[model samples]
Target: MPTRPLSNEVLQKTIDVYIASMRSWTDSAKKLGIARSTLEHRLKVAKRRGMLGPMPKALDGFEVKEYSEQIGKNGEVKSRSTKYSPEGGGQFEVPDGYKIKGESVLTDADGQIRARWVKTKEGEEDPLQVASVVRGAFEGFVAKSPNIWRLKDHDEDSLTVYPLADFHLGMFAWSKETEGPDWDLKIAERVLTETFQELVERAPKSRKAVILGLGDLMHADSHKNQTPGSGNIMDVDTRYQKVLPKLCDIIIQCTEFVRHKHAEVEAEFKAGNHDPASTVAIRTGLDLYYRNDKHMTVNTSPSPFWWHGFGVNMLCGTHGDGAKIKDLPGIMASYKREMWGSSKSCHAFTGHVHHELCTEKDGTRVYSLRAPIPSDAWHSAEGYLSGRSMYGFHFHKDKGSTGRSEVEIL
Candidate 1:
C-alpha cells in the first residue's frame, strides 16, 4: 500500500482544529486519526508555506486568554479577545499582504513579562524583487522625458547647492539640563523649513538646485534608541512610526519649494553614523513619492562620497565620518575621474561635526556647513558649543562659486 498525497487544504484545516483543541501533538494526531509522523510532516509543510508560525508555549494550569489588537484609524491599539481557552490558543485574522512572523513577549517598565502575541507585519520580500515590482508598477506612469526643461547655452547660468546636515529630525533635548534651546521633531522641522526657505530667498535664481542631506537625519537607528556603531543611548522624540513620515514630508516640502524656483532639483542623501539603515528607508520612500515627477530626482546611493558636476564646477559631498578631509579631493578624483577631469573647480561639502568650517587642500576647497539644530545633552555637556546656521552656495557655469548665503539661528 502506498501513502496518499497530502492535501494542503485538509492539513491546514486539521491543524487549526488541533490548535483550537489545545492538545499536544500526539493527542491531536490520535484525535485526527493520523500517525504522529504524518502529522509532523504536514506541519512542517505548513511552516514552509508561512501558514503556521512557532507553536505557543504550554500554559499548564494558568489561564490563557488570546486576543487580537484592533488598531484604530489613529493607530491606537484596542484589544479584542477572540478566544478564552484556558489551554491557550487563538486564531487572529492576518491582513492581506502581511503575515505573522512569530510571537514576542511584551514587557512593562517594572521588568515584568506582561504578555505574548504574534508579531504581524508586511511579508518579507527580496529587495530586487520589490524594486522590479515597483518599476513594473510605475513603467507606464514615468514620462519619457529624461530632461524636461530645455538646456540653454548661457554664460551666467548658476546652480545653487544647499547642504542640510545632521537635522537629526527625531532627537530630543531639554532646556533644564543643557539649558540651550529645546530640540525635538517639531522644532527640527520648523527650523529646517524656515532656514531653508530663508536660504532659497537669499540665493540667486538658478537653473538647478541640489538639496544635500549630510547624514544623521535620524537620531536613532534601531528601536533600542541607540546609535548604530557605538550603541550609545540617544534622546529620541518618539517612535519610528511618527518620525519617518514627518521626515519624508519635510523632504517633499523642501523639494517642492526648490522645484518651484528652479528648472531641476536633485536630492542627494548620504548615510550617517547614527542612521545607516534608516537613511536607505528615507531614500526609498522619497523615490516612490517622486517616481513620476520629471523635474525632481532623488539619489540614495549607499556610497559615502558623491559628486555633482555643472559646467566647470565639481561639487563633491560626504558625511565626513568615513574619510578625513585632506584625502577627499584625491578620493573624489579617483572615484570620478571623468567628472574631475571635466571640471576646473572642485569643492567638497562635508557635515559630521555639525559646525561651519572651511579648509583648502590641493586646490580643492572643503567646506563643512553648520546645522541649525540645537545641541543635545551629550554635545552640550562636552562644551561643543558652536554657532548654528544654514548655508547655500551659488556656483556659476564658468566662474565656479559666485557667492554664498548664510542664515544663522538666533
Candidate 2:
C-alpha cells in the first residue's frame, strides 16, 4: 500500500515525540502509531522543508514575518533570508549572519503602519566579529605563557593618569597635503610609544597609574576605512588586519612601560566615533594578554563612559562625542552618585575636538585633552588645526589637580 502524506502538524508532533523519547526510532514510531520507515520518511521530509533543526525565531522587539533557507546539495544551509516586522515602536533586530539589505512600509486603508525589513546573508565579516575571532586566537596564544612583571614602590597617595587622546593609529596623512607632519602606521607607532615613554619617565612616581585612552585610537573602525557613526570616508594607512594587531602592540608596549614605573596600572580605552569596535578588540586583547598579571588591570567594559576612584578623587573619562562637555558633570553625578558624593574633587577627561579646553561646572572640571597626532587630510582641508600634544595629570589624595606633565609634538 502507498504511504499517505502526513500533515505538518503530525510531522512536527512526531519529531517532538522522537526528540522527547531520546531519538529512539523504535520508541518514537510506537508512540506515534506509525511504522519506523514512515517515521524516518517524515523526518526526511521535515529536514528537506528546513523544519528539522532550530528554526529562525522572532527577534526581540520584532516578529519574524518570513524565513527561507537555501539548502546545498549535502543538506547544509547555504544561506538564510529573513523578513522581520517590528512589533511596536523601537529598533529592530537583525538575525545572525544577516544584514539589512532593504526595507519597506505599507499603509493600509485603515491607516495602520506596517513595516518590513528584508535581511540577507552578510557577505563580509563584521568588524566586531572579526575582533572576536582575533581576540580568541590571541587569547589562546597568550594563555600558554603568562608574563608577570615586578611591581615598583611609589607614592600611595597620588594617582597619575596618562591621557592618550586621538592617537589615530592607521591614519595616513601626507605632510604636503595636510600641511602637518606626515603620519602612518609606522610613524604613529613610533611617535606614540616614544612620546609616552618620555611622559612616563617625567611623571611623578605614583603607586597607581591609569592609561586612559580618550578615544579615536584608530583612524578607521573597520576594514571599510570609514567612521563608524557618521560613515565618513577616512584616510587609512594600511589594511585593518595589520592595523588592529599594531594597535594591540602599542597598547601593550605602553602598559609594559607604565608597569615598570608604577606598582599598579589600570588601562581603559574608550570608544571614539572612529574606532568604537576597534577599541573593544584592542581592550580584549589587552585583557587577555594581561589576565595573569596581578598588578595590571585592563578595563574591558563596553560602556562608553569609564570612571576610577583614588583616595578622595574621582576621575571619569568619555569619548566626548556624545554628551556635551558642560553636561558631563551632571552626567557623572547622576551615573556615579556614590563616587560623586564621596569624592572631594571630580574631574572628567574627554577627547574628540582634538584641542585643549578646560571648563568647570557644578564643581567638576572637564578637560578636553589635545591629540598628539597631526591633522588628517579632512581636518586640514577644513582648517581644523590645533596644537598636537599629550598630557599626564597627577592627583593628590587630599589635594586635587596637583600638576601635569605635557608632551608637545613639534
Candidate 3:
C-alpha cells in the first residue's frame, strides 16, 4: 500500500487549508480526503494558534474640566484656570516660562490645582508645576469615555492594513444571537459604522491603508444548503437593498478618513464562499455610484482589494476562500501553482475565518483578519478556541509592519 507522508506533513497541510468553509472537523475531513479523526487531530493545532490574543490594557482616564478661576492683579482681570493637581496643593509660586504673559495663572479642579505665575524670580521653581491643581466638585458632570483607539499624540507615518473579512451581509447566524435580531441588516449597519469610526480613531496617524474583505459576502451557504435555523438570514433582495446602501455609506466615511492622510487609499473586495452573487451585485452598485455626481472611480468586485494606484507589481486581494480553514495553506499553494502560476509576489487580505493571521507564501503577505462581531463569543459553537483581538495591519519601509489596531464600537 502506498504510504501517506509523515504526520508532520499532513498536520501542516491540514492547518493551511481550513477556512470559513470548513470551520468544523466533519466538513474539513470530507474536503481533505482524510478521516474525520485525522482532521480532528490536525485541527487541534489550528485551534491553538487561532486563540492568540493581545494582553489587555487598563482603560486610560479621561481629562475633564469643571471649575473656573481668575488669577492676576484684581484690576488686570486675569482668568484663573482650575486644573487637576495630581501632585498636591502648595503655595508654589509660578516661574518665568510663562506660556501666556499673565500676572499669574490659577487652574483649579476638584482634586488638583494648576497655577503658574508669568513673572517670578529666575531661581524659583518652575511655575508650570503650579497649574496642576484642580478645584471643583468632581460630580454630576459626565466625563468623556476612557476607551481610546490609538496612542495619544503619536505622529508616525505608517501604512496599515485593515481586513473587513467575511461580512456575509445577507447572511444570518445559525446559532449566535446578539442585542437585537441576529443578522438584522439595520443593526449590522449601526454596528459596522460605529466600528469603523472607532478603528479610525484608534490609529488616526496611520497614513496609508490596505482595506480588504474576506468573502462570504452574501451568506449564500456554498458549502451546504443551510437550513433556515433560528437566524437563517436569506432575504436576498431586501437584505441587499438594506446592506448595499449602508456598505457604501460606511465605505464613503472610511474613504473620507483615509483620503485625509494617505493619498493612495484603496479598498479591495475578495469574494467568499457564501456570496458568489455579491460579485455581480457589488459591481453594479459601484457603477451606479460612479455614474452619479461623485464622478470618482469607486472600483468594485472580481478584484477584492483596491490597489488605489499603488503598484501593479503586486496584486492586492481579499477573502482567500478556496478550501476549508485547516487546508488554507494547501489551497493557497494550489492557487499558486494552478492559478497565479508565477514567480512574482502579491499582497492579499481575507476574512472568512473570522480570525487574524499573517503569513508569507512565495512573497505575498496573506493577512487573515480578525473579525469583530458582537457574537465573536459564539465561535465556541464552532468547536474552536479563537480570540477577538485581531485588527488590521500597515506596511512601512522603515518600520516593516504597523497599524493592526483593534476594532471597537464605542
TM-scores of the models, in the given order? 0.62, 0.63, 0.45
Q: Specify the highest-TM-score model's number.
A: 2
Whichever of 2 and 3 has more TM-score, that candidate is 2
For model 1, how does the per-residue alpha-carbon lDDT over 1-410 read when each residue is reduced to its tens digit? 11233455776776786797684788778888988777776775454333453333223322224435687899986644443233223344678768887776655553333455767889888799889989999976944222223335422478999887888888999989787998888888888877776676666778888988888888887678988898898889999778878988888777766776677789888888988898899889988998899989988788887789999999899898888989999998899999999998999998889877899988999988777788899999999887888888889989898879899998
**Candidate maximizing lDDT:** 2
RMSD of each: 26.6, 27.1, 38.2
Q: How do the residues 79-183 of candidate 2 rate in per-residue lDDT, one tens digit apiece?
A: 988676654454566777777676666654433345444555676778998999888888746331223334455888888999878888898999999988899
Alpha carbon RMSD to native, model 2: 27.1
Which residue segments of model 2 deviate by more than 4 Å? 1-153
| Worst 10 contiguous positions by lDDT, candidate 3 | 51-60
Locate the minimum summed-lDDT window of 10 residues in model 1: 55-64
Candidate 3 residue-wise lDDT, 1-410, digit = tens = 11222233455567656564456666667778889777665554333222111112111221222335455676563664433212323344444443333355465432122454444334544455544322234545654332334234434455666656655554444333323235455655656656765666666465456555555644543233332233343433244455555665655655454444444454555666566665456546655654553313445646433342222223345465554334443444454543334424345556667666778765556666655543422344445433444355555434444445786432
Poorly placed runs, candidate 3 (over 4 Å): 1-158, 170-183, 204-207, 220-240, 287-297, 301-315, 323-347, 360-365, 374-381, 384-386, 397-399, 408-410
Q: How close is candidate 1 to the true structure, as a TM-score?
A: 0.62
Better of 1 and 2 by TM-score: 2
CA lDDT scores, all candidates in order:
0.77, 0.83, 0.49
